[model samples]
Target: MLQNFLVPDVLTHNYLVNGFCKSGDLETAKWIIIDMLCRGPSPNCATYNTLMVGYCASNDLDKALDLLSTMSTCAIRPNRVTCNILVHALCNKGLLGEATKLLGEILEDKPESKTANLITSTILMNGYFKNGDISSALAIWEEISKGHRTRDVVAYNVMIHGAGLSLHHSLAYRFVCEMYKKGLMPDVFTYNALLSLLFKEKKTTEACYIHGVMSKMGVPPNIISYRVLIQGLCINGDVDLAKEYLHIMLEDSVLPDIYIWNSLIDGYGRHGDVQQAFYIRDQMVASGIFPNIFTYNALINAIAREGKLVEAHNLKTEMIFHGVYPDVVTYNILIGAACRLRHVHIGLLLHDEMLKKGCHPDIITYTQLLKGFCLIGKVINAEILFDQMISSGLMIDHVPFQIIIKKHWRMGELDKAFENYQIWLRRDK
Candidate 1:
């Protein structure tokens, strides 16, 4: 097509450029832009912005910024879209300082620039909250509230969500009240945020009240809403109440997903009601929601926690029958259980099985196995496992160090124990 079309217009060039950019072929996209410049219809600002966005998406932010400079040199004035692409990329990468500087520069250049609009402000505020700079996030919102940027429902949601995430439940509630004063209705996201905060704070009555308000407000509860409530109730050790919500969801024709079932199963399993957990799993299967790795893992973890190693292992076979192979988490739960039961032999067997099944152990796997060895008074074996963990490019935490220290002290090796304790102290620093 390129051979037949002698002179491709700017639009055609941009079309090809966008295709390459979206496909993550930034190098090819750049070459095409250069080819367009060498040919006719020199690239425009949109052309440059497309390539810049591509660069940012590829995580080559430095190159993207350089392209922005090139745009200025070529007398192609960048618009708000160009600024937002860079700001969002920086914010997403957790480079909040750089993002703030860039945003300030864009606002100075174009005060009316939509680049400093609600979306970008929300992004900046979210970055601040995530970085533990809540004061900065509140300051940004103060500016928005003062009419620097048009305050919208989404902007309110961001602040509310951020407050909840930062563990400021009272502030989150205040924000919701403020939203009502501003004549803005809270959406499902807003409720989810508040509900999650309330649940975490053990304000179950308040969370349930908000759920009632949601129904009154005509914002039909979503699957996420149900999931959050169920999980929260389960977390508070109210599996029976959580199961009631599940029944209500079913009555409302809201088909529950695997996660919903898994939460209840885990709740019941953790409460030492293995029968109830299995009943939930049976209900899940009846609902045509096939148990996945997560379902079986929950069951295995629950049974393992109850010191039912044989039952947990039996569930592993059942999991395989359902075509779900054991992952590292499954083995870790079993290994931890075996250690707690003083069955180090079974834990070692599971470790070898994980290796034979091509499932590499992670840090938790090594840590659990080390603890098992240490608990069994096999300090030499624990040391070997610890060394192997470090050689595999994994860092050792104080848990392993403490195990070694305690074991040494028990064996009356005072010097060795003190030496390991010093090493642990330095590592902590």
Candidate 2:
């Protein structure tokens, strides 16, 4: 095929480039593109776009940008696909300023090309939301919404998901209504965003109503649809309802993944039904799904909070035996449990174990240890741990200082209390 200068050869080579890039063989993909450039059947925008996508996917943004310049040198104008791929790649790196500028450049350069305007704007709007720039996201949405060519279902979906992330329940609903007004039916994603938003707001009733409406409208709920509901219901203390949905999800032929299984296990365990949590774990294994670190963490957290350290430790051993090693969250839970149960020795030992496991102690781990030491009148140990926190580069927060100050004050050490308070004030300021 390469020996022949056929018209479809370029497309065949482009497909090969895509395959190599997807498989993380950027070198071979770039080689093919270079070969196409040197030989007959010269690479076009599609060819360059494919290679640029591969570079972007590999986080070689610099290489991707360099290829854009090469596209210009080769007399190939960047099309909508090219502009979108680059804009999205820039956005991914949190370069909103650069991304926005690039977007404007692309849109301005191709005044006749209206196809990419909506897609790029949607990408930019989503970037803003991800970076916690709600105002900028809304500003982009407002600009695009005013443009008939740019206002589409995908743009609406971005707005809906952004609203959920921002917890703007009314805003999401407004967008949903606006979609209807524009003759754009709300999609599965729209309802899922609403489900996520309502759950975050603890508006369980509204979330359920939205789920029901999704069914009524004949928009089949996918796996995400069920996962969001189960997780939210479990979090909001409606384990029973979540369990009911799990059965319904299976009935509807929507397969439950590890996440759904974890949610159920955690929910039941949190509701003080450890037996049922274990039952779910057994069922998960029987269904050929092995537990991950999260599965163990959820189970450990449930029993550890109930002062069942022995059982939690046994599970920890079980997880280690099964090669599901403890992460920071795992140790944090065990330490918190030990502190609350007045087992400061166990807390200290666990802290050491976390280091041995090559897991750095976070602010939470330090705070829990500080509390444990302070509670036991180990003021000197607490002070040493506080210094370690600073040395370890953990973000110092109000809680740790408060714990130390209260401890000193309780022990009638006015000078020490005032000294720590001054340090806290200085750091905070």
Candidate 3:
């Protein structure tokens, strides 16, 4: 249809570019702007602002600044949208100092600009929170409250998340209280953020209090809310309470996901209750909730820790049969268990499988493998893997390097050990 129409005007070009930008097609949008420029309708300030927004959305701040320079050269004055995009980009990048200077520039030029009032304050508040500068965040919040007649939900959510992130749980609670005082009802996000944080802090009592508040406010708990509470109770060793929460969740018609079941299994495993963990797994399968790699890993680790090697190995085979491919963590757990049980052949076979599957071994994976080799007195093989790790561009940390050095020294290879020690010292310096 657009192809059948007459050539688009500047406004039509801007509209198309905005659509493309919002939909994440920045390169195509740039090409469209170039085509528009070649067709002799000089790009206006709106066009430049639209392009700036595109760059901001793509997180290409350097290109956005370059476009700003071009706008200046073309004598195209940047408007509120342009400033807002720049401020948001800078804030996201943690360039709070530069964002402040830009805000100063805007206010100096247009003191009465409503866009200046909204975007600048919002950006500053969010930036301060993200940077963990809570005092500054609160100051800005207070300032905004004094001058602005309306505060939106995003603003409140940001403050809540910031408080939670900074470990100011009490302040976060106070913010919720203030929300009520301002006659604003707390939203799902507000409850979720606070509940998640409280769980992380192991403040299960406080989390329950918030959950009660959520119920009183008539905000039904979402899946994430239930997951957080369950995980918290599990970690706190309140397995019975965790099970009760699961029952309540089911009663509330919230279907449990794999994560919820995994946490329960893991909690039982941590308490050395492998039988109960298996029972939960059976229940999960019976309920038609397919177990994932995490579920298998938890069961494998639990059984392996209990020295039930045969059952653990069988579960690994069943995981494969069920089409749940083992991940790096799975291999790490299996290999570590094999090494602990003196099953070197199994560990070696698992390592071969990992390489065949093209899973790039991370530092932790390599460290565990190297430790297993050293434990089995295969010093030469460990050294080969260590050297390969270095040649593959992986950084060797101090602990693993020290392990190799100590092994060499214990084997009376002092000269070789000292040579490597010198190299490490140079790098450390």
Candidate 4:
């Protein structure tokens, strides 16, 4: 239908281009834009803006900036949307200083652009907050309050969200009250900010109260709302309640994402319900959420606790087959499990496997093996591994040192034990 009536005009081509851009097919969008130019509708600022935004979304900031020169040569002037795209992309990449410089250029170039002022100011505020410079973030807010520009709900939400992220609960709550006093009825984002802050503070009751308030205010909860609730419940060890919420999320038609599934996997595992952990993992796969490293690690830890050594090792094999190659933490869990089961040979073999895979062992890896050797009274072998660890230039942690010293004392080598203790004490100094 579009091909019949639209006739490859800029208007129709733009809709197609934007569709591709939004779907993250930037190259397709670029081809469409070029086709529009060749077909002669003369691409406007919005055309370049759309393509620039696509480039920025793809993290090709260099290409996005090059569009500026391209647009200028075509006598197409960039608008606030174009500048904001660059500003936001820089901020999102944590290049705050560069973002601020671009913001300054936008303001200087388009002083009367309220959109530019608001967007640049907001980007600067968020960038400062993300860079852990709360004072600078608040300074931006203070300037906004006193400047010619009025503070909008978005600016307030950024400050609120920033405070929540920084764990400044008091300041976040204060922003909530301030926004209300300004008659800026807290939206879903505002409520979510407060909810997340409450969750982080472990104030689940307060979060619940905020959830109720959201329902009463007719502000519908989004995915983040349900995620925070599930995460908070899981963290607080109410796996059953967390599961109930997950059911509610399904009922509400909110498709659970990877994070939600991981939370459930970890929560059930920690609740001593390895079966439930496995069940959730299966459920996740059935729901089309493939397990990642975290998923396998959780299952491995739970299975190890149940003394299902063979099953835990099988999961490692399954993880490899599923293409979720084990990480350092994966090897650490397996090695620790093997050590606890007095299977030092298995731990040593796993260590060798990690080295073969180019996953360099950390101090935890060496310490776990030392503890394993000491557990089975292989003190001499443990000491040899300890020397190799030292020769490998790995920093000696207290755990391995204490493991060796304890083994010496237990074996009635009091002088060796005392000598090791003296060495550890000297290292501390």
* Model 3 lDDT tens row, 1-429: 457976678888899889999999988888887887777467888888887888877879999989988888878877766777888899899998888777777766745655456667777788888998999889878877786536666677788888888889888878877888888888888889888888878888998888878888899889988888888889899887898888898898898998999999999998899999999999899989989999999999999888777788899899999999889888888877887777777877888988999876677777777777877899998899888877877777887788788889989999979987987898788
In the range 260-353, model 2's lDDT, one tens digit per residue, is 9999999998889988998999988988899999999999998997899998899999999998999999999999999988889999899898
Better candidate number, 3 or 4, judged by TM-score: 4
- Candidate 1: worst-modelled 10 consecutive residues by lDDT: 107-116
User: What's the residue-level lDDT of 210 in candidate 4?
Assistant: 88
Candidate 4 residues 111-213, lDDT tens each?
7656558877998899888888899889877877676776778888999999888878799889889888988888898888888888888888788788778
How badly does each model clash, as a count of residue pairs? Answer: 0, 0, 0, 0
lDDT of 1 by residue, 1-429 (tens): 568976778999999899999998888999998887677588899999899888888889899999988888878887777777888888888999898887677657736644357677888888888877889999988877675465777888888888888888789889889899989988999888888888999989888889878988988788999999999999998899999999999998999988899999999998999999999999998999999998899999989988888988999998898799999999999989998887888888999999999998888888888888888788899878876775787767777887878888999999989987886787678
User: RMSD, each candidate, Å?
Assistant: 4.3, 2.2, 5.3, 3.7
Give each model a TM-score.
Answer: 0.79, 0.93, 0.72, 0.85
lDDT of the structure predicted as candidate 4: 0.86
Winner on TM-score (2 vs 4):
2
Q: Of the pair 3 and 4, which is ahead by lDDT? A: 4
Alpha carbon lDDT of each predicted model: 0.86, 0.88, 0.83, 0.86
Model 1 pairs in collision: none
